[model samples]
Target: MKNAQKPDHMSLNSLVNRLKDGRYVIPDFQREFEWSPKDIQELVKSIFRDYYIGSLLLWKGKTENFDALSCEGIYGHQQNGGAEYIVLDGQQRLTAMYYAFHAPEIRLPNRANRAFYFINVDEFMRENFDDAFEYHYQSKRLQRLLDSPKAQYESHQFPLSVIGTGGWDLLKWVQGYTKFWEEYPNTEDDNEDHISAEQAEVYAVNGEQFGQYIKEITDEYQISYIELDQQLGIDKVCDIFTQVNSRGIRLDVFDLMNAMLKPKGIQLKQMYRDVMPNVDWVDTDRMNVYVLQVMSIVLQSYCSPKYLYFLLPGQLKPIRHSDGRREQEILVQSTDEFRDLWDKSVSSLVRSIEILKHPNEYGAISPKYLPYASILPVFAALESHIWTLPALERLDGTRKMKHWYWAAVFTNRYSGSVESTAARDHQDVQEWIADDDARPALLMEFENRMRNLDLSREVNTSSSTYTGIFNLLVLQGARDWISGVAPQFDDLDDHHIVPEAWSKKHLPGNTWHTILNRTPLTADTNRNVIRDRLPNQYLPEMFESSGEESMRSILASHFISSAAIEILMRRDFGPNDFEEFINERQRTITDAIQDLLIHERLDLSPRLRELDLDIERVELALRELVATNLEDDSERIPSGVRQKVQQRFEVAAKKDPSLDPENSRQMSSLLPHFDIRDIQDTLTNKILWPVFSSSFTSKSDLDLKFSQLASLRNGIRHSREVDDVTRMEGEASVLWFDKILTK
Candidate 1:
């Protein structure tokens, strides 16, 4: 970190230009790419807004090598000036800007902050746009004062910042900050100095208080990225990337796709630029970052296997190394295969979720499994021809029943390990396949269990086994989906059906699967979905208010899934959409599962209705027995309560098949499903630990704990009591009701 000799700006500048040539990409040994969507957005804002972007500093040295980095993103510098290109700072911004600016359209692959546009121009325009005009960068209302093309060209660094949202916004912010400081220094604090409250009140140049602030800056300054050297190797370049750039802005999943897919064919590039921004029935805002994490893993298998995760511009990407271009190519291919496995993936996922309901999903033995990856099951289900009208009646019975769990487990593995070089290396993977005997042993036992004719066995959600297999299918499916359209399995992100906070707020984090948090989406579309704070059925405008036409158009086009749209209409609400969101998600998820699985022979309609209305009638013959757990007789239960319970049971039995017979519980046992133990294991591993705001309180009391729940419960419960329509009950809803009443 010692300061080197200070060469003249021109000397340093000359070296800088050479360091940026294509050959000087980052060296194989460096830190992983780390940045988040929020960071990405902030960086864009800073540069476009014109706040002083930091300088790139470099030292002369051949540092220790760690791993490998991709050859793209960093321009190569001539080694004539130095042995290895050295980077001082601004690596993140440089990499991001390089890739983003080159691409005609770059969508944030992260579910968040993907919406900002990079300047898109044809090749001729890209090379000559500056030559055609009196390119002026107005700062402090300071125009470039251009007299000729030479003056504009020689004025400063090339107009590296594209004239678009990401670039323009950053330029504006910096310029605004500079102008204010230049005009009225000493008026106030440092960052916001040079302007007074009185002036702000008049012209409204407040400290990012109003939207106009960004506009004001953008109106004046244009981003000027000054690279001191283009000849620097990636190792040195990365040092700069790690240092100064934009503070908070980083790349998302889409950014990863752009980086890895940089050299792929034009068709691939077009797909990346255009089609990848529009995934079907996926919500990018809620799951973009997590999706990026998954894609990073997938992409790494192809071009830059070891450090593909590091390819992300900022935070949240998981890779930990430098050189990984070869690894990245392998990942790309693998991801393409995975996308092709979409149907099977979704099936495996749904089944795993069902297993989660069994309360064994997070059991001690397989507590690592998360429902998120269970998506792979959907793929398996499809592979097994489960997407047809009827599912497979039976598979071979195996001991451990891990057959249903492989997809989910694989998905979890994919998401977790891609960032680690050793984990992602081809040699390591080969060894794993050959030596991971524990899982192989379990798979043998699982197939044996599957062979038994248990057509009626319900899917178990809690079993880590089921969730694991589901993820595998999801990974596979994702690979399949992107192959033909997107090269090297690039530009995908997970989309949230509901915003992530829903799970974080309503369920324990332990109950949540990182994989479960996302569904693959095109990177650009992912960015469009930044936060998913708004209900999907009616997307809100970021700037302007939505009129009726826009609202109608949104629900019709974007909802994509018919059931999701229906669910929105059914909810009949707009106030405090967070609550409506949860309800709508129930319908969306159930329908998607049914549609995708096709063979489970599920009836999604039942899922659309609320769960609270379901009731299990107590059999007169079994009441005495079922009640034993509730009683010290009168000692534990008050007379009024016992009477009410008995009365309710009597009423339910009048038309309820579960209670009409002498042995209703016995009759219920005959229903078709998977192994009871398997289901039980799933529930234990997963659902056993769901959290609620009112963990120990009833649904009626849930409101008192958190305002969101309180209002939701009140709305749903009260609306029902006042309803005139008849309702049918489903087990899922019944489960929901039971949790509410018991907790």
Candidate 2:
């Protein structure tokens, strides 16, 4: 029962004309259009140059419902009933055509005088080069092709690229662009990536545009291949936008969040936008995208696509919704509650992440959500008695508060209905009150399990320390997330500690997952000291490029922190350290548990039951390991292996001790067992002969040994052969500590 498939074709002339007069729209249900004018203009220039590219997105429908925010400034939509297609993918590129052909001047922010540039690199272009023209555009290339377009168009056979500047810089740039595109390259009859003689001739003539050029390209070469399908809608539009765009070149959630908040009222939306970015850590640092994620979670809790809105700063209207009345109602309903909740939560969360200092771990979890847990603080601030169970039980007015909280986070973390509101009420109705004996026991059981899970997952090498920061809040109640923050010990890099570098080496997979590679240093510091710098003997008295004082301050500040820098200086320089290859995102499990506990407590019952049973087993086993005797006479661990392993663990631990597994038993449990055949006698403990120890008393002491772990790790790396003394010593100490803890 589906409509028959048909291929609909519209030429470049019809598509451009349709877009020019505003006949097509992106649709109301579509995601908000976000493309800088410069990015759009560049793409437009590409179209005129006749690049080896094809396809324009066209939705097939007549007067379909789309997002109201999406319809603004778009090409006109056709109502001619026969399979009208919505422009889904090329919204940004198409919008550039509007500004290029229509707008007198473009409006954009944060763009300095990076002017528009057009370069004609053909053999003929090599001569028309003017030194004065070069100085004007800030490029050493020819200008003045506009004056004699015909002669230049016939002569030049080159590829053209146009760049539009952010500000008045574009004036000089557009002039340069005019010269560059004047020469058209020929059309290729071969593969799109390959160059051909026909293409060269085509590109030289039709490449540059100025009203007339659009006509010429339309006549000689270009045609729009409109790809159409039935499943074209708002979601598809958003998904495509997200996919095709690069970071910082697309619409951010904060922008969308503000757009969504607009439904509350422009005043509220503006107020939130103006104030929300003031945090020194979030904005000025140019880091913490987790803040954006929180905004999305918060927005979702309020409403969905049709009714929701965001009021971004500087925009006259709501960015998310066009309907003011419905938007205003949602805004008024959501803002007050969200604000009170956010204000407290952020203060606590900021401190926690800074203290935990795990960028690699918390990279996926947003810092904005950190404030969700602060709902208790908000409640505590507002009413004071809401903390007690009897007071909580008597409270039905707070049900809405609970509802928003659950939807924001709990819904995403768990796969159960046990944490739902229905389940919470069921418990309340059953009299699990404070005075009940069952209540105290339940509280103890809950807290004990939480403490164990927190200790395990938060500091585990594989987890993002960012998630564990919340535990820091619970244990050491800091007023601000950064207040208790220690000096940048230089032990852990927020990654690329030296900051400035050519490029991070390409790993075929996700580079950010590695925690050993991740660091907690500020963006300024991180950017300055990028991966691969062999730490100079001393950080200079003054760094010339950034001219920032952070380097000088950190160098003189703390002894332990200073010592960490020394270790990094002596270590080999490479971006692909084992530290960066992070695998265990162990805290996600706790993140789920904590989120469920706070948000949808009732709906998470089944999940909670599973966690309870699993955690109990882990607790008993850990305690038993701690209780075991570690004295072993049968086989002594080679001192060389133990020392090597100890150093490696210490190196990363210095980067982030909180991420280092807790307790000697926990640390010892992950070590590789050594045997007599594994031990090879060598030099000053640098390179080691392989030795798998036959017997060891400690459960997992090997996991925490840094030196042995790295050296024994089979990799194409260079190292001086190591000795047996340090290895045995490290293993013996691990065994000794395990014995001590057990007794």
Candidate 3:
């Protein structure tokens, strides 16, 4: 019997050919293909990522066995009478591979239309797996795109059907794609729709790179299989198949745990069923697994599937002592003790969900808005422990937990490998809750990420940051426009502040769909009040009905400041107004996040960052003025000023040996080091005054602005205090310089 079966592996290329030739067959008892396009897309991603796609169990087919269990070819495999192996397991994965590789015209499971797959070469080059692979159902628009090679090349989307044909097909496609882009300029206007040589080269390089990856994955990637001998009797094969698949399903870790616990008289499934009603508010696909995870976390401070075995009754757990010593101990000595832990985990999870759902608290109005369900077990375990602290300590701990939750969500800490991150966060957050100084490292990371985060690009709702921002908007008591009251949580919809219909028609950019332009509004308000109208068209009507002052307060709840409201109220509002409004709202939203979630003052990071960039503009203007006029002998720099710079360089050269007076580029580099006053002097010089005059208003105006800017720069550079009024003046000066110099 041992010799009846042997393990063998096949390259992905060979496997695809076998499926195409109808060499592999699925028994009638095997379930039909049930994979969604998303499931197939994920499988493709895994194959390309070199992840193990798991082994197959194939029975060497016999006529009698085929008769006993009516074998059929894989989906979209039209060829017949070539069956060599009968698939016993991994049918879903096998069929998914066939569907993706063959580019079948069959409908996806439960979907209406046939699906087609493509890889976005640009995103693939960036390794953005989430956006790189996509499957689209048949549509006129999609068909048009698929038909046009020029559109395909421009979009960087390569049809996967090319891979199905094998041998030089992908190479030919890549060459065609490259040639199309390289010659695109001949057919298009260079001034309006130019494709630079550099951009065309990028497309060619990405295509060749992608083709190489496809070849490597198809030719070298292996799929192992256990081949059962054909000589085996049909009865034996039937028994083997039944053994592998009982009750039409495979056993997962939870089922295995239940099997292991049966003799100990503990029904883990029954315990989970009992807890389900209590945790009805917590929306998780795997509540049963989460129960075990919470128990594992509370017991051993770990919750990976491997670690869950330690929680089994009488299983040995290595315990660490306060003296840095370890001892082995049984985690669960009896079934009653296991039940007690389960009960406690369920109770704590209930409390955690309550906190998460409470609008005044964490404000995940529903499970859909919850940024990361993977963090729940650790959060529940920690929540239970926090409540056990003294009253004063408990209050502080809860406050810190809020910060930790927001930090984890915004930083996307639990996006991958949730077990280790959850365990680490559990420990780090607990420590942070007890000691104010012991801030979790994630807070610092979140602060750094937020400083440069382009909120306008966060248009995808699936992103953790995008959802976190929505939850924050919900927490603001976002009132309905008509009723001027917070709507029921379930009734609220994430609607666009700047109407998407108007933006699509008027604006050139796609920022209207960004989180910066979205907020929680009641469905009634969205459908009845908003209804495809511009903010200027609708907001004033609401202002007249709700009163302008009351409307301002209501808009403020949605992070719309008075500045943004003014822009939105513009009767002649256009793309610039939309840009200015969203930018203002972004600042207001960021300020709220800093004040509430991060527990810090809204620092001038973005403004200060912008200030630094504008200062570079000032320096570059000075350099261009000096460099352009140098050879012309404009005397922009007087003899006295030249001597002053040379004297300064001599002193500087004595301190630093790298100072090269001979190199023109190195000499020009010293222009950036000149103080603002030096820049003003160079700009306002009598000879250079005419050249700089067109950029600035006048010498007196430049003097007044530059002087204020110099004080602001010195204070900011040297870590000295600058008052609000001085900061505002400095902002004006920076804006004035940026506009004039950038032009």
Candidate 4:
């Protein structure tokens, strides 16, 4: 690194002249132009008020290296100097100033077109200022006001383009004002003419003051810059750029990478742009970051979140070679090696994207639902091996890859510590491919991680987890509830089954927004037909119009089983029956999630069944233990324990169809009948723990065992999968009780 020059203040006029003469260059490593109209307006206002706008950092580089820029219109006559100054910091501020003064019109990020104008201070102060002397002059808002039909063009509102071009002087401005008065003259109304004369008198008296302010803004306002010597390297320059921009959006790692590769005659941006159009499913603007991330991962096994400087030529080396040259640590010496790495990395990225789009694989139709973008690099790392192989030869590997991907999705393995998880998984998956014994272990690890994930829990529509599963369901041919047509992801709106208005009035708090009640539909169907109506009312009408086949299709699309639909068909629209309907539908959704996440996995199914059988045996043992121990003191249960037992009993009692003769038989058959004695008969170890003999020495230890058993029993009875840790604890508790019974 070379020593930087001392900071110096330069006038705004001189800076603008440098910009116009193409003396200032913006390097390709700089971020794209992103300043909005509001940003520009505020910057102009600050400069007008003579506020300090901070310093700029510039690198004095050779003219040949400054051929490309992130944006245009900063070019004019090139100076005959030996070296030019390239802007490394303050690009946005300089770009805004240059466009405001020189360009004919500038387009904003929101696609709004605007032109800059000098403020009419005298007229504005005379007509709008109060006694306090504070005035508001928002540039864009004021420009819109002046452009309106009812507003007259003021004499002082000169276009900035003409002012910076040396075409307008004070004498010419005065002549233009006189010509304007001659053209429009005065209205016949005495009051209007009197007001016009008052405005004219104020402008005439303060004309010199207005000219002086304009001169001060255009010529005298100073902008400070810290200039770096031309001898500095790209690495040092990138470091300075990143350090100075710590407060705002810092430079992307890809930006630094692009600069490092420029000397080799390779452009990272153009390479990505050329490959982007080939992948039609990707939204280029949104997924560009992921693509760059995948490239980094393919080149190096790990991606550092902060920087990619380590991947440059002198920093990294190939560990091994195809020629068995393991003794030598070979640096990336030639452009050939760089070009080969780029091609392989991009090929891996394209393959990963294709795999995501495969309907039978992850079924990721879009990037909208990608919960962890960090996982994409893992895919790239795995897919890089199959790049040279044909598609048919890679089938088995792809299948194994998809299993891992789905396991990651359901288990949320990449959720909290994303970068570290991606790195670990990348190395693990690579090692598994090399060693045959590691494959089965990897699959088992995936199964264990996924065992306890409760997909039945309600999720909001905007949640990434919910969206991921929803997209997968749609890709499996889920149809719209109204039209029975496969709905497009972008076109679908999340529709509430039992409309929110009626649910709030009848059901529990916000129960209508749960995953079970929400499904996708076309915007027209959601807004026009399903607006604020009960399911019983609209569903019956839909059935009548669309017939049974269509109605069943709609129900199935939302993962509602035929049995649940039958119960819904017979239910009444009365006040208290909606909760029962939601419960039945929720069970149906749980079953669908099980099938989607663990479809046709024979090993997982048998393990789940065996786990459930063990839980049932533990529940029976607990009941026997409670009946034997608590027979003499059944009525002495603690208040807290009794309250929990009563809550469970009340819930079961409400679903007893005998209480409501109008309820469906299917719902009644699914629910258990509970009486006061039933609660007393099956005493959980949690409630009767103190009554146990001194053989169970530690109450805390026994409490943990009973808690695990209770959780396992509830999950088994309610058709949920038990997690591995809870299962192990419950099994150990059952064994301890069994030994006591045998003794």
| Top lDDT model | 3
Q: Which pairs of residues collide in candidate 3?
A: none
TM-score winner: 3
Scored by lDDT, model 3 comes in at 0.78
| Model 4: lDDT of residue 266 | 71
Clashes of 4: 0
The CA-based lDDT of model 1 is what? 0.34
lDDT of 1 at 409: 37
Q: Which whole-number lDDT from 0 to 100 does residue 107 have in model 2? A: 41
* 445-510: candidate 1 lDDT, tens digit per residue: 333333331211212444443443333323223321212232122444545534555546655443
> What tens-digit string does per-residue lDDT give for candidate 2 at 1-743?
54433445554555555555565556554455465544554454445555423345555544444333334446322333332445655565565554444332334334332223233434213322221011112123334443443433444322122212122332334334344443333244433445445554444343333324434554454545455454655465457545645353544444555555566553434544554544443313322233332332233331111112232322232344556443222332345655654554344345434532343222213343243332222222212222333543434323323333333232222211111222232233233332221221222233334445423222233232333333222222211112124323332233433333322354334443333233343344334443354344224323443243554343322211333444444455344432321222224334444544432232323433343333333334433332232232212334555555455445434434243434322335323222211222211112211222222232244334423333322110111122465435444433443444345
Work out the TM-score per prediction.
Answer: 0.22, 0.25, 0.57, 0.45
Rank by lDDT, descending?
Answer: 3, 4, 2, 1
Q: What C-alpha lDDT do the candidate models reach, one value each?
A: 0.34, 0.36, 0.78, 0.58
Cα lDDT tens digits, model 3, 360-458, are 677787887888788889999899888788865675576667778888888888775477677877888877776654666677677767777778889
Better of 1 and 2 by lDDT: 2
lDDT at position 515, candidate 2: 31
Clashes of each: 226, 142, 0, 0
Predictions: Cα RMSD each? 24.3, 23.3, 12.7, 21.4
